[model samples]
Target: MKIAGFDIGGANTDLAIIDFDQGGDIENIKTDFRYLPMWMKNEELGGYLLDLIGEEIDQLDAVGVSMTAELVDAYETKKDGVLDIVKKVEDTFDIPVAYVGLSGMMNASQAISDPLQVAAANWIATSQIASIMSQNCILVDVGSTTTDIIPIKNGLECARGRSDFERLGTGELAYTGTLRTNVAAIVDKVPFDEGWFRVSSELFAISADVHHVLGNITTEEYSCDTPDSAGKEKEDSLRRISRVLCGDLDLLSTSDIESIGDYIYAQQSLKISEAISEVAEREFLDEVITTGLGRNILAARAVEMAGLDFTGMDEFLTPEECVVAPAVGTAIMMEDYLSDE
Candidate 1:
């Protein structure tokens, strides 16, 4: 059987495809996964998403979807986008569609008691690995709009608080990210031509562009909100950086751009480290497992600041396995139901 796991985020959509000959564990299957930035073009996101499936969309036997689309600003209308996408899958391929709910140890009725509690809670990949990686740890998942510092006590995901909104204020939420952070949200001051200038509070360059200039983040992941990013020139980078800082390239030098990017990286690093420490203080976790895009950078900074050992989600699984872990983990938890023949 062929199975696909879809993880929809605010900035990107990740899809993992796996194939199993007989009805066996998903972990034992071969898998392929890719992260695509489809959030920038919200209007064409659905079409762009379909394009990602390539030839696999037509041949998959079963598919499951886990989404964080509700975090989008236009969520009021696209709240059902996930369901709509699922409907497209059903319509195109005539395959089974599984909407992963936030319940591996409980019933759907109990899990739905708090709907927004849903977020990416349906993902079983990190949870499954966490159970084995570290028993007492905090899992820090940093995506676009938020960073979830979920406490894992005795190999289970403990509730951080009452509601998601509360979690947003706490370190459980760090609205800054590597690819899509607003520069104004990070620092108010910018040094240009040996003078400090205030930055604009508008939506300009993303944290990705800043990191790209500083060489902290890779060009591969420099997927900011730049138009036609695939063809962005050095001039474009300079312009984007200038807008982010509320300065022009003529007013600044090449060194200024690099400095601004470094500053952004530093600010982001501090925020992540602070949040990780908060979860550790509250839960008294001895270990922390970091995942998502900013895992390595955040973990490195966290280790230096907190004097704690940090582990990556990839450390416990193979490259292919790690890519599909969340989706495969979700499917693994649903084994009893899917295999109840």
Candidate 2:
């Protein structure tokens, strides 16, 4: 069976195409993601979906979807956004389509009936991999815009919070992520030049800039728009990061800028670490399974910082596959749903 799964978020839409043997074992998997700012082009989603599918459109047996794009500012309410996105998927293909909801996979009719059931539920699809990977662990997926930390035990997702709102209170959701998070959201002050320099709340730079300067991700991997709309080169990142201190290159030396990047990186890791600690302690889970774009750079580092056992999803799937694990999981899940039917 061939299945395509899409994880649509506010910033990026990730696609996973999986081919399964008759025995239901994955034969091969291909994944890719595009930066589609839904706020500006929510109407063009159908085109983006078709572009991702490309030639595979003729071969796909089914398409599964999980989305967080409903929470984007493109719509006045989550319900409205959900309806619009669902319509696009429904209109885009004649093949079988299902939406990944909080309760496993929902048919297109069910999704349209209760849109909130599927709104911002991409994390749940990603968490399904835990039962196959480990018996007791927390699944931490750090994407470009947000991090999903879900607890699973004895082959079941045992998250205390079902919604993003509830997850935030349970420490299962941390708003900061690898690329798009504002640097100011991570820290208010940085220690430099023998004094603590407070950062500007202005959108001078994003986590991508700091990660670029720190060499965590490549310039090409900085898929989100740069804060200053400048080049994604290291120097451009350095200059933008300097603005976090309310200054430019002329005011901050290279060493000073590197220091700021280091601090921001540490704090970002610490944020995830603290959340991991809280969730791990509350759930009695001692190991972490990290995946997604920031899985290695941020999630693994945060796992170490939280003083827990760490397992990168790359161990089971290639790093490329792990980067889009949610979509992969959603595809596998849809395949299962269809087979059962």
Candidate 3:
């Protein structure tokens, strides 16, 4: 059987194709993640999603979807966003479409009726798959825009909350991310010239700039639209980071900009570490299953700083699968559901 899984977000759309035999073993998997920026192109999302899947849509036996795009400013409310996304999937695909949510797979009708359960529920699908690998582990997924600190126990999802708001309250979600997060949000002040100064709260530079300057992500991996709308060149990254201090490259030396990057990266790692500590206090998990684009650089360091064992997603999946685990999990869950029927 062939299944196509999609994780649609405000900034990016991720798709995973899973081929499974009758015995439920995965034969092959392919993943594609694109920077669609749905907020600006909401009207054209249907076409974009179709283009993302391409020829694979014709051979799919089932489709499963999870989304965080509802929170984007393009939609007035999450319900409207969910309904619109579901409609687009229905219009694009001929086969059955399952919307993966905290409660599990739901048909388009069920999903539309209970949109609240489906909004921003991609983490549940990823956590469900992670639980199958290790029961007593925290799933720390540091994606492009947010971090999910999910606690799994006894091979079951033990997250303290379901909704994004509830998850934020319980420390299961952190708005800080490795790519799109603003540097100012990561640190209020940074070290420069043997003195500490408050950073400009403007949208000067994002976390991508910090990682790029620190060499955590290559120039190509800095995929998001830059704050200055400039190129992703190393010098361009430095200039953007310098703007965080309300200065230009001429005013701040390369060493000075790198120092700021180091401090912000450390602070972002500490942010994840603090959340890990909070989830650990309630769950007693000693190991973390890290996934997402920042898994190696940010997630691993945060787990180490928090005194927890780190398990890279590559241990369980290929490098391609590691970054798109949620989409793959959605397909995996759908296969299991279909097999049971």
Candidate 4:
């Protein structure tokens, strides 16, 4: 059997294709993470999705979907966004599609009736899989736009909240991320040249700039467009980070700009560490399972800083699989659901 799963978000769309043998053993897995920027080009989403999984779409036995794109500004209301995305998926594919909701998998009609259950539920899918892997562990997924710190105990998801709002209150969700988060959101002040200085709130730089300057991610790994709309070159990244302090290359030395990146990175790491401490204290989970695009550079450092034992998802999954764990989890869940029936 072959199953395809999709996790659609505001900035990126992740897809996973899994093939199982006759006895339901895993045969092959292929995954793709695409930067769609759904808010800017809502009309082109269907075509882009189709292009991502070209020939394999015809071979799939079923499709499972989880989404967070409803929060994008392209729609007036979340309901409108949910219904529109459902329509696009239905119009593009000709298979038994199941939307992964908060409760369980549902058909498109059922999903439309309960839009709230489907909105921003991709984290649940990833956490469910993590629970199956480790009974008492915290799953920390730091993606391009947000971080999810979920607790699993006794082989079940023990999250304190189901919705993003409740999760935020419970310290289960942090809006800080690796790629697109604004630097201003992470820190209002940074230390440079043995003194602290306030950051400019001009949206002139983002977290990607900081990461690029610190060598946390490669130039190719910097997926989003740069703040200046120039390029992802190291020099460009350094200039952008300098702008955070309202200083350019001419005004600041390279070491000064690097110091700014280090400070911001430490601040972001502390944010995730604090959230991990909050969640870990409740369940006493000692092991942290970190996954997502930023796991190596951000999540691992955060876990270490929090003084907890950590395991990268790469220890269990391929590098490509780690980036789209939620999509793979949705597919695995759908495969299990079908196997039981």
Candidate 5:
């Protein structure tokens, strides 16, 4: 059976097309993501999904979905966001559509009945994948806009918070991310010119700029939109990062730019590490299984700072595959849902 799984996040929508053999083994998989800010383009979702899955729609057996876009301010309430997204998905696809919820995969009716359960449960799908490798570990998923610190014990998720709001209180969610997070939110001060420089709390740049200037991500890997809507060039990122210190490339030396970017990168890693420590101390787990676009750089550094045994999902999945792991897990869960049905 062939299934298409979607992880519809607020900033990007990821898709995984998995072809499964008769015995339930995955035969092939193709994954991709599109930058679609839900706050601005929420209504264009249905068409985008169809376009993303173009040419293969006729051969698809079913569709599966996991989303975090409900938390976007585009909707007045999470319920309203869920219902609207669900309607778009329902209207777009002709085959069976399953929503990955906090409990398990559910049909549209079940999803409609309880929207909050499906609000931010994409991490649950990733945990399902993590549990396959380690029954006891924290799954640290650092995506474009947020990080999820999930604990799994005995092959089941033991997350304390069911909602994003509650997860923040439980230290299972960190608002910092790789490409889209505001630089001001990560650190207010940076090192430059042998002196500590306080940064402007404006959205002058994003984490992508820091990573790009530091060579953590290439121009192509800076997948999301830039803070200043500038070109995704090394020099452009250098300029953006310079602005965080209330300067420009003309004023800041190359070494100064590197120092500021490196400092911000370290502080961002600390932010995620602090959350990992909190979840680890609470769940009593010493090992971490990592995935997402930031898995290698941000997640890996944070795991090291947390002082835990770390394992990258790259052991079982390629680095590219790790980018949309929740989507891959959503496909697996949907296959399981089909068998159960």
Candidate 6:
């Protein structure tokens, strides 16, 4: 059988393809992944994505779709977005399209019967994937705009008491990231030549500037959106951070820029630490498994703040590959569901 899985996230959409016959090992799998900006804004995003797959759609025996879009809005808005995509896929391919449940980690067989209930339970793609990667631990995924903290025990997701709405207050669901966060959110004051000066809340620094200075993400990843990240130069990163100080790049030296970046990390770290503590207390799990682009840095600061040890996903998987670990894990879950039937 030819199978394909797609994970539509807030920042990017990832697609993975696999081939397998009945009672045979699935090999020769190929994956095609891409990063798109403002993906949720494209009304025809469903059709736009199908066009990318082209002929591959015809060869697929089954296709699966999963997303965290429900977290984006209210019930009707989310339902419309998901169903629209599902209808478009079915209309184009004439194949079965199963929407992964958003509330809990379950197979299509189980999810198909009651996706609403599943999604309502916070059935996210990460938990499904985390179940396969770790035994008993907290899964921390820091995405473009937010971070998710999920606790797993004995292959099942533990009810952490706090819902998505609650976590949002603790920095798990904010419009901040390692590459895109506004500088104003990190600090209220900036040091000038002599003493200190207040910063305008209107001005913000890109999370890229912060991560670059902190040595978390390299220039390669920072090259996309920052004002001067195109050249992949340290000077550009410095300039990006300095821009937050009202385009006064020369006002602050490179060392000062680095200091501001460190300050931002420290600020964000405090917020992350609070979120981690809430999750630990709610689930009674002390350990946190970190993943995603800023997982390493966020986890490090969170550990120090919470007095907990941090386990890096990189210890088991490469950073680039780890970003899509949930997609891979969801596909693995799909394979298991298909085999059981």
- What's the TM-score of every candidate structure? 0.80, 0.99, 0.98, 0.97, 0.98, 0.79
lDDT of each: 0.61, 0.91, 0.89, 0.88, 0.92, 0.62
Those runs of model 3 whose alpha carbons end farther than 4 Å from true positions after fitting are none
Pitting candidate 4 against candidate 5, the one with the higher lDDT is: 5
Winner by lDDT between candidate 6 and candidate 5: 5
Better of 2 and 6 by TM-score: 2
For this target, which candidate reaches the highest lDDT against the unseen true structure? 5
lDDT of 3 by residue, 1-341 (tens): 99988999889899999999989999999999888887888777778777878887778899889899988988899999999888888887888779988888888899988999899999988987788779889999999999999999899888988899999999899888889998888989998878899989999999999999999999989888998788999999999999888999889999989988988999999999999999998888887899998899889999999999978878888977888888999999889878777
Q: Per-residue lDDT for 276-327 in model 6, tens only?
A: 7877776677777777767776766665698876677767656664666555
- Model 1: lDDT equals 0.61
Name the TM-score of candidate 3.
Answer: 0.98
**Model 2, residue 298: C-alpha shift (Å):** 0.9
Clashes of 5: 0
**Candidate 1 lDDT, tens digit per residue, 39-119?**
444555555546766777777666655665545665453434444444443454455555555454223333344444345
Off by over 4 Å in 6: 18-32, 39-41, 47-59, 69-76, 103-123, 161-163, 169-175, 191-194, 227-233, 315-318
Model 5, span 23-107: residue lDDT tens: 8899999988888899999999998998889899998999999999998989999999999999999999989999999999999
Query: 20 in model 2: Cα distance from truth in Å?
Result: 1.0
Residue pairs with backbone atoms closer than 3 Å in model 4 (clashes): none
Collision count of model 6: 12
* Alpha-carbon lDDT of model 6: 0.62
Q: Please give, for residues 84-201, the per-residue lDDT of candidate 4 as tens digits.
A: 9999998888987888888778789998888888989898889876776688899999998899999988977778889888999998999999999999999999877678899889
lDDT of residue 140 for candidate 6? 78
